[model samples]
Target chain A: MTVVMKMKDIFDCKLLMVDDEPELRKMVNEILRREGFVKIISASNCNEARQIFIHEKPDGVILDVSLPDGDGFSLLSEIRTTSAVPVLFLSARDEDENRLLGLGLGADDYITKPFLPRELTLRLRAVLSRAYFPVILKRTEKPIFRLGKTKIDLNSGAVITKNDQLMLTAKEFALLEKLYENRGNIVTGDSLCRAAWSDNLYGYENTLMVHIRRLREKIEPEPSTPRYLLTVRGLGYKLTGVEDR
Target chain B: MKNLMKILTRYVLSAAGVALILLVVNFAALITWTTQSGKTVRKNYDIAQIADSLLRSDGGYTLPETARNKIETNRQWAMLIDNNSGTVIWSLNQPSEVPQSYTVSDVAGFTRWYLNGYPVTVWKHPDGLFVLGNEKDSVWKYCVTEPMAIMDNAGVWIIIILILNSLVAVLLALLFGLRLFRSLKPLAKGIEDMAEKRPVELSTCGLLGDLAAGINDTSAQLKRQEAALSKRDNARTTWIAGISHDIRTPLSIVMGYSNQLEEDAELPQSKREQAGIIRRQSERIKTLVSDLSLASKLEYDMQPIRRSEIALAALLRQTAVDFLNSGLSDSYDLDVIIKEDAQNAMISGDEELLRRAVSNLIANCIQHNPNGCAIKVTLEKTLGNCSLTVSDNGVGFKQEMLDDLNHPKNSARLENHGLGLTIVRQIIKAHGGITKFYNLAEGGCTVVLSLP
Candidate 1:
């Protein structure tokens, strides 16, 4: 959990929070600050937001559509002439038309008012991650997955759970990666075996089943009746919600 | 006005044509009557002309050469009777067919019956009384004797008149029929337009003008009523919208602060537990407010369903996975079973609404059966309909709630259950579908949403 938060470089980055409501700006700033975002400057109007963009050179911005001075759209256009900094719209206007308009204007994301603070933090982290860093997505080189107490450090080829670390073979890690790649969806057995075993698919079915059983034992609390790693009878297997379950 | 002119032209042409035909026909019949009766019957003019012709040609007391020649040429014979002696004093070309000498009784009988087939009439002259006689065949005998021949000629004339008038009748029928048809054509088009929910646009004229005016009035009334209804619905939507905006902001603050406190590990156990309680209760208020707003939208049919093609099986799987990942207690297990056909079964609907409908059913299962139970979401396609069933091993809905669902008009009964099931029904209805409540024989409730 700590590593995922550290992956996004918010230490040197700055965010400009623009909203007409002082309370919402304060609340969201507090939430982001707690999530390791150190530098967040606030503005209540588009002119102040624009000035902050030029002076402070914020890495990202959270803007409200309705401002005391002007709308968020004009400010977005003004910002566009100078930089390609990521902008997320946080507004009270939640209609489909408004959402489309904001997104079409090249904003990173659009979140309506009265949203979950955690959701905002997660979305902002995602936008920052995608915009600044492109290395975290290199699965073959440095893949890291966290599920409950289990963490699969694919680079080191180890599964750590409850202060105990277990080494994993290259094939087991490969199968697990395939399932994780298509999370919350059924991964067909044929495709799983094909991905883990490059060729000789005719005889790979039994081997794939054995590998699945072994992988479940490592991840499931009760491996006899797995919860997260489940079988779909004749068709495939689904790996779902490892974080919460 | 144009149609009126056409109708007027038809009536005038028909009447004038009929009058001219009858005039010619009646004149021909008159000539036939006069000529046919003149050859035989000695009417008053025939007798008078013959006597005058005889007197003008007479010389001294005997018939002169001109008188004899006139009598022979005109085919007439005359007898002179002396009034003093009451006897026949002179006679010229008097055929054996007539009684030349006559007593007072004989004169009366001959004049009354035209004795011996000689049509005779007596004219009292200066010298003697002249009785003129003509042969019955020389004139039209039946012209007076049988007056029905004149009626027969009139009958022929009437037929001729009617035949001529029939041509005009046909023309008049066509002209008026055309005008009537033109007037009624717009009425048909107006009715079709109204059927399509369009306003009636008809020009009133001719015979159906009154009816067209009535239709226009009805169209205007329909438009006014629709506007009024839309206004009412808009007012309701705006009210609910305002409520959502005003209520959610404060609730967000409450939930945010309490959540932060509950997550603070340095806080005392009692304080943390208290914070948790506040957070959970505030979450409930938030749910209630959101449900009320959605219900208002559904009740008025004001929520526009933004639709798209959705892989329903994938959505079902996604719903179950999301529920498992929602960070709730692992007291309940939710999973999905999708058939191969259902995996690719694409249903058209608003993704957000479908998500809400399915999520509500799963939430209901976890909420009502606090002891926890298994939830299974199954998806399948049959024929053209997609049936999504959210089944749970928990106790099914109470009998009272099930019965209340049947009669939604009873407000008291509707309040028995929470808004979740009502929302499910409304959302599915908006998608042109229906929802059915069933208790599995194996001891659970199955909410079936059949989408078309």
Candidate 2:
């Protein structure tokens, strides 16, 4: 069982960023500040980073691969000796070998330089949340969803409307669960078939359409002109989130 | 090895031809010598006709004046012996030391061989035996005789000897041919190895020693050139990597600051829009730098491909979905249609690179059409190969760009399309696939990527 975490708790976590460039460190500091991260400490080299990391005991770390005094991989190994703190590598090396090496050395994520500010903040937040507040990330795995007035209980394969209850077959439940997972985003017919039939969408194209129709009839207010369950023509289908309508 | 056999065959044929020419020359010389010697002997006179000219008269045997004159002018002698008396009945110009009479055994001996020291010719006449003698040491005569049975089988003997001679000639040819083949085999192999870029070292100690040495030198020179070329390529790749790496930090700073300013609510709308443009251009620069580095790495085979089995249908669907979900505008629409047969089409490739290739094609369509376009990506399995087609209904490709793509060696105008399409071609080529680009007649372009 996992509990939901408040946004304030995420902003309260401490983050340590280590890079060789001072300007990059300052820019990242500013970016994090704007993203509502209250605690962020920085170091310019490996020695300073090690000192800060040992004394400050930060909840997460963002490290660069190259530094003046030493490289980040060895520093990561050194840090791993005493702690399980989430470490994300931010470096200019975008080669696959470097990415694999960083991840192979127990990094939580590898983000190349010149990245979008939002992407960096989001990755940093995810790493921190995974490390200190994993229960909050797991809370969204609940097996229940609401589509308009119809309520879906995935665990029991039941659709409860205002006055009556309906049941979904195993295949229908699988398809609904896949669509619900990517709610408000397009879920391709191929992906849905793989989820529902545990096979490809070759011979199951019409079978998938029939199942989607039955699923919409159970979950939507108007089955013919569906509001929640929708089709993105030539692509696949999209299920709207509960708050969309 | 095939060349070795050709050389051996030529050597054998030449050797046989030389032997045959020698045999024909010797036969021709023998015939000429025999005919000339016969003509010289005939120029002297027909010795047997002298007896016919000797006519008997009332006086002692009278010789014809012509015959007497011929025998005397030739510095020769003539005589006749009586069969009853066994004595010389008539003689003319006979040497004084020569016997004028002969017994039966003596006559037989002189007729077959010689009279004393003189070589003579004898002919039988109705009157007696006639003899003609030449000067000593002027001619040589010998008698040859064979049994009838041996003479009768001479044709068979000549044919047998001819066959035996031919067999020996062929045998000798084969022996010399094999020796020549031994000397040349290694050199032929060396040349072949050099052609294939393999190191070659041949022994320089035979009839073909100079040629072998030349081949070895060429191979060594090629090896040196190859090493130098690889070194240059390595330097180029490293330079690109260094430049791209060095630019990343400053670019990150610029992008970060510009993004912050663009989202700042206190700024004026126009100012924020200007900041947004700056951020977007900076993002474009970031893409350019990465693409430049990737293109270099791929060109030099420096990028390691991580291969895995990929279902192309699912991959295409996921790519289209990601684009749509990432906020593709209403003006532009993207669609993915996977053929039923292609839904199970699987390939072994680097998933990331292939995904990037697909993404580049779609991005190409979006980049070319600012006013919006409809992009359709389709996947199908044809003849055991996976064929992916990305077509767009928009401003089609420029004719120059299509020409540049068709002839990649002169791809000077590839910069107009950016490195996106070029990198796509490189990635697909690396995976042993072909990329084709053409404009649709309906005012758009289509790119077909076929992977085996």
Q: Candidate 2 lDDT, tens digit per residue, B205-299?
A: 97899999999999999999999999998998889988988998899988888888999999999999999999999988999889988888888
Q: What DockQ does each prediction reach against the true complex?
A: 0.20, 0.64
Chain A TM-scores in order:
0.61, 0.81
Candidate 1 lDDT for residue B251: 67
TM-score of 2: 0.93
TM-score of each: 0.63, 0.93
In terms of docking quality, model 1 is: incorrect
Off by over 4 Å in 1: A1-8, A96-102, A136-140, A144-175, A178-245, B1-181, B292-306, B327-335, B339-343, B393-395, B398-418, B438-444
Q: Give me the displacement of residue B289 in model 2, in angstroms.
A: 1.0
Alpha-carbon deviation at A89 in model 1, angstroms: 2.4
Q: How many backbone clashes are present in model 2? A: 0
Tell me the tens digit of each residue's lDDT in model 2 across A1-245: 12124334667778899998988989888889988987899999999999999899887899998899988889999999998889988878667345555357888887888888998988988887787677755765557777867888876889999999999999988888898788889998889988988877767878988999998888888899999888987668998866422
lDDT of 2 at B431: 99
Tell me, by DockQ, which candidate is best: 2
Per-candidate fnat, comma-separated? 0.13, 0.77
Q: How far off is residue B117 in model 2, in Å?
A: 2.8
